[model samples]
Target chain A: MPKVTIDGHEIEVSQGTTIMQATKQLAIEVPYYCWHPGLSVAGNCRMCLVDVEGPPKPQIACYTQVTEGMVVHTQSEKAKKARKGTLEFLLSNHPLDCPVCDQAGECDLQNFYMDHGQYDSRFDEQKHKKKKAQPVGENVMLDQERCVLCSRCVRFCDEITGTGELGIVNRGSHEEITVFPGKEVNNAYSGNVVDICPVGALTDRDFRFKCRVWYLSSQDSVCPGCSQGCNIRIDSNLSRPQHGEGERVMRLKPRENLNVNDYWMCDEGRYNYNFIDRNRIQTASRVKEGVVEEILFEDAVDSLASVLGDAVREQRHGRIGVLVSTQLTNEDLFFVKKFFKTNLGMDAVESRFSFPEGSSDDFLIKADKSPNTAGAQALEVIASGTYQSGEDLIDKTIAGEFDVLISFGVDIDGLLGKEKLDAILEKVTLLAYVGSNHNETSKKAQLVIPSTVYAEKDGTFTNVHGRVQRIWPAFPPLGQARPEWQIICDLSEKTGFSVSADDAESIFSEITQTVSSFQGLSYEKLGKEGSLLSTVKETVEK
Target chain B: MEIPEELKKKWDEAVARYEEKRAALLPVLRLSQDHFGYISAEVEEAVAHYMGTTPVHIREVVTFYELFHTKPVGKNNIQFCHTLACNLNGCEPLIKQLKEKIGIKEGETSSDGKYSFSRAECLGACEMAPMMKINKDIYGPLDKDKLNEIIENL
Candidate 1:
């Protein structure tokens, strides 16, 4: 341990600790662009100037290691003037296009300006201009004018993503961040470049101009787009009274938790919420004799219980099939399985656990599309088929002479090629489809229950790696839709298996009590930040 | 390109004031560019290899930190910082007038290679943007005619 005095505050830090680390530990963040926790240090910004007691010239705290009895002043007049000078010089060539920059509120340059600006423009000359924006990747846009040349995003690609696509082209102030000749900045983690850019230099092609960050209400959640379930922050402006009132998530960013995806999220997860935002089939409408009439959720549930219950009671238990999607939350999966097994005494709860294969990146994630196949497996939910797995549920549906079958899912029909699913649905006498989207199965269902989208539902999704993460509701349920857990609980009451399902805790307990893999997983333990419940892994070290 | 033994020895002595081999990037770039009008890939590669880093890393520093060069240039590098505050005062016309006076475009080297004009990001002189740096000399607070006169005299 070493004793260091930073800004007159005496502090003790571990040996070999940099002055930058000490500053951060002391709740004093040194403004920098080139130094990221995950990457090697390249102190190019020079904005993190500090007056070390012994050094005649100011040292960049990012690279300077703290020694015993060392004194550092980050707020000294000399240090202040030095940082201000650095900022002013940076601004001389910078185009203050904050109005146009997508990274406006969250930009580091903006933060540094407010912290160090002398409130005076010293330049009596013209500003240098560069290209406004260049689309560098499938999901990344580079604005050369807004770039401070800190090279954080460029470093992120080379070091973390291992994709050495982005580089600095040309030279001097004429220098701009660009990809190498003939190569676009296309990498699986290319979106992370937009996240790391200190200035508005790199912007996401997907999130540009959707809504300003100041207006976004953020909620901690995990990406259900894949089994990796990278922890994320869902930012939205849905709480605004001006917009058609509903908490609509505008963007998804990686929350900085070293345990999960470290400051990086896949573009698929970040952009997948767009479908959920607009296409929520949130109404119980039945086309009886082509006269489509909207019915209340209660009436629909009652009818569903009676018809399915009578059909199952008459025909038999195994004849009534059930489909549970891997996309369903742990609580949702538990109750859906329970509704068939306990209430109907029907054991044909066919597993809807399947998706198209996605390629993995060098960063922290699996390419598997469904977030919770492993959890579904724990609940005895088998994959429908190998290649097109969810279709096996329908394959079994065709072979098994069933009177009624209940399938619950989102993205099931899309997974099970449209024609095949449609043809299978025609043969079934009674079909109940529950999901967030109006897929082909939902359209053919005798009863359709609109389940809350992952963003609007608070529950748990077990990622492919067996990491159980908490996905919280970013907004209120849309159009009388309920969380799958609540709806399944409602069905339980109607069918004579009465149980309360007020909170995720109650439902989770029922799951852990019966389910072997989820034995220790309690709602209280399933933190808002999320915990990985992997059956395959060993330690919690990232 | 091989440096003279005298200057190389001098640089070696002066390098220790800074920490790490990479800290010498600015001085090395300036010295090389000064000795032989510009910095080529050969010199940058040799330096980077010796520094135990990639050429791209050194290239990023040279491209970013204003004090480095990556291409062949004229004897004098003429850089003008035309940013927002500077533009408000009148740099647009000044640059246009300078182009006419010098008979050269903004990013072009003179036919004789005696002078090359380019843009500087900030030059640490925001107060003097719309300002021109000729080699090491900085001149600001100018009208279009003033730039015309200055380059004409040069």
Candidate 2:
């Protein structure tokens, strides 16, 4: 270990660490471009210039090596002047286009300019002009004028995704980035280039100019897109109404969960927040016949238990099947199984939906697509593990063994198709549903209990690889809708089991002790930065 | 290796700077630009590859900084510093005059490429408002005839 003093702070770092690393270790930030922690070091920008005692001139801390006990000062007059000059030069021809640049508030160039740039410009000359608003890829629109040309995005494509789609073409002033003739930036991780581009040179076509980033607020939560359970932040405007309800979700962005998704989310998850808009069904209620009756909290539980009890004792297995969807949280499934299996003693607990409703691209999305199947099953919830397809589960429900059936599902109807799943739901005596969307499944259910979307509820989920992770709620549940645990807890108390209030931690603890896989785990230790719990089993990327 | 005297002079100057290899860039580029007039593709590639930054990275300083010209400039780079003070005054009308006299638009050189026209931002000479730099020379409070005379001389 080598110890060094940076700006009067003494710190020890491992060998092969640069002076830049030492400053970073001490949290004494030095401005830099062309050096991303995830990418290989390219000490080009000259922005992170630092002063060392032995070395006469300011050295780039990124590439400069740190020796034992060598003094370094990043705040010297010489260093400051050098940095200021560099910034002035960098800003000379740069179009003051921050008003329109998407990276305005978060841009490093803007920040560095304010921090280290000279107040007075040096150039008395006309600015060089370049083409603007060039479409670089399917999802990205590039502005060549705004490009700093750090090549982080290009390098990310080449090295990270192994898809070398973008390159800096031409040379010097005439240089611009473009895709190879026939090749486009149409990779699974292509949207991330927009995120990595330090300037507004690259902007996502989907998110471009919809709303400035400053207006939308973000919440750290897990992605409910797939069983991968990549942690994410839900950016929304709470004051704005949903369908004029005064609160709505605008977009989904990847939160930094290093273990799951390190600041990158698949395009599917990023753009999938559209359905949660006001037009979508968020409130819970059951529709009987042609008349829709919205029942109170206690009544919903009693009605469901009574309905399932009637089906289980007097009726048969196929008639009174329980279809639990993958989008459901562990708490919902826990109480779901408790209400049916413990109280009614029903055997049907299988997922209502599986993965890949569309084409399966070989990337983050998996074929077995439910977000929380493993968690539901880990609780001894009666789930048909082998019966993978949503249509298959619906087919078994329509086989006529039982009369009344219930489903806890969302986004499942599309996979089974409307007519196919509806034909199966039509055979049942009573179809009760707890879902976020009022699609075919919920419509078929004689009683519908409006469920909260993943963003609106706080719950724990078991991803595909059996890693139990907790998801924090970004927004409050929609009006009259409730978390699955609360709904099921109400049902459990009415039906039979000793049920607690809607406290996820208590339920998780109860599950953890009994379930051998999750022996000594607690929500407190499930990695705010991610630690490998023994029971996590295997790391699933997709 | 036989290095040009001018190149060696640049090298010596870059070495004289406190930070040798790092400071070598600006001087080297300026010398190369003097020899080559414009920083051509081959020169940019060699400089970037030698400097360990990509051509794209080096291009930022070359284009953004007023001094470095990625393209060939005329014998004289006619500049009107468009800083706060200059823009406040009637630089627009003055630009119109210069444009007409030069017989080429701002940012364009003559057909022979003897004179290039460009409007620069603040050159840190606020007191000398409406100042312009022709290569390394400074001219301020410029008018139509002064601009024409300067262009004609160039």
Candidate 3:
């Protein structure tokens, strides 16, 4: 350990920790742009300049390693002057487009100008111009005139993705970041360049002019796109409904979790939140005599209870099948398992929903598309070696083994093709579909109940690595939709189970008491990063 | 583009000098620039393929250095010194004379494709003052007639 004093604050750090990393522990903010903790230090952006007691000139904090008993003054006159000069050089050619720039509220250049630089402009020459609004990739747009030449995006493409699609093309004042003449920056994680860009140079095409960042509220959540369970922040404008016709989710940003996806997420997980607002089941409905009619939430719950009660009274538990989805949270799965086993005495509960073949990389992506398949296994919702695959489930349904089928968050069209799904739907008597979206399964089902998406609920998901992470609600549930756990609890009460838990936190505590895999974990204990269960399997496969 | 077998052997020999393949990028680029008239996109891609890197990395290096040209040049490429020492020693008159006599500006090639001219920074011949180089040959400390005679002989 080396003891370093930064701005009169003393702290001991590891041998090779940089001055920027040490100053972070003392709550000293050193403005930077090109120095990302996740990427190699370029040290080209001189905004992190700090005065050292022994060094002859000011050094960039990102590249200078802290020595034992070294003294550093980050707010001294020399350091401040150096930072101001760096800011002046950066802004000398930067166009004044803050009012129209998407990164105005969160840009580092705008922030450092107010913090370290307050001088008048000294540049009287005509500002250099380059390409504007160039489409570089499928999801990223580039404005070359607004770039600060940080090389963050270029380094990101080269180092992180191992796809060197970007580079500084010219020299000196003519230097501009661009791709090769005919090639484009198309990759699995190309949208991350837009997130790593500290200025308005790169902007996301999906969220370009959607909404200003100041009007949106953010909440920490886990991406349900895959089993990697990358941590993310969901930004939504819940109050302002007049923006884009009830589309609440403005964008999804990567939340830094060093153990998980550290400061970076794949484009699939980053842009997967659009389904939360599009093609959603806003209200409950039921099919009556070949005509679909919207029904009340209480009526839908009562109708489902009557079907379960009739099956229990007639000793027909073997005919009642409940098909759950791995997309449901751990708390939702736990409640569904307990209700099916203890209340209805149903032994046909299974999770036969298979996700489509999603692309995977050596990085954060996983071949398993479900976010909580491990949690489903841990809670015994899908029993080991007894659960049927998606095709087998469709075969079993067409054979008339299960007269009453209950599904949650499982897209039937995706599992089996439309022909097979339609064949299975014709044989089932009472089909109750509970999901977030209006898919083929919900359209043909006799009963359709809307369930809240992951962004509108608070729960935990056990990833492929068996690391549990918590998701906080960024906004209220749309229409009459409710969390699956709450809906399950209400239905259980209607069926005379009396689970008595109305909220996710209480049900999570009950789950911790009963489930051995979640024995010692509680909602409060599983902080934003979440705790890993002690009993993770050696090798997890789907 | 396919590099010649001799140049490919030279590139391999150059690559063998460095421990890491990425370190051989500059020398390999120089070799390609010498063999070809200039480093084109195809040449950059070929070098990147040979060095196990990307074309953007090769492009970054070629654009950063002043010696490597990315576009095609004439048979005789003339580089005029434009540093403070050369400017104070009457390099401006030589530049003007070349521009008028060659019927082309600093970065333009001649109509017959025999000559091309460009202004360059210091060539490390400050003692020779107003110096210029053409095809690996440096001539300096000369008047207009001496430069005209050299051009006429060429």
DockQ of all models, two decimals each: 0.18, 0.04, 0.78
Top candidate when judged by DockQ against the true structure? 3
Write the residue-wise lDDT of candidate 1 on A16-90 in tens digits: 899899999999867887888878888988899999998799999999998999999998998988899899888
| lDDT tens per residue, model 3, A1-542 | 99999989999999999999998888899999999988999999899999999878999999999999999999999999999999999888888798888888988888988999999999999999989889998899999888999999999988899998999988888889898878889988888899999999999988998888888898999999999999899998877878757799999989988778888899888888878999989899999999999999889999998998888889987787788899999989888888887677777778755666778878889988889999998888863234476456557778887788888887777776798778877888888999999988899889999999999888889998888889888888889999888898888888888866757888788878888878888877888887787686555322
* Candidate 3 chain A worst ten-residue window by lDDT: A382-391
The all-Cα superposition gives candidate 2 an RMSD in Å to the true structure of 10.4
Q: Rate the local accuracy (lDDT) of all candidates.
A: 0.75, 0.72, 0.87
Give the per-residue lDDT digits (tens) of candidate 2, residues B1-154: 2446766677567657856565577777887788878876667666766666555545545664567777788887888888789878657888888778778987898988778989887887767666788888888777667767766776
* Candidate 2 vs candidate 3, DockQ winner: 3
Query: Which segments of candidate 2 are over 4 A away from where they belong?
Result: A180-183, A240-247, A293-299, A309-319, A352-363, A383-393, A410-412, A530-533, A536-542, B1-154
Superposed on all Cα atoms, model 3 deviates from the true structure by an RMSD in Å of: 2.1
The CA lDDT at A168 in model 2 is 74
Residues A391-445, model 2: lDDT tens digits = 5666766666546666676434666567766666667777777777767667556
Estimate TM-scores for all models: 0.77, 0.73, 0.96
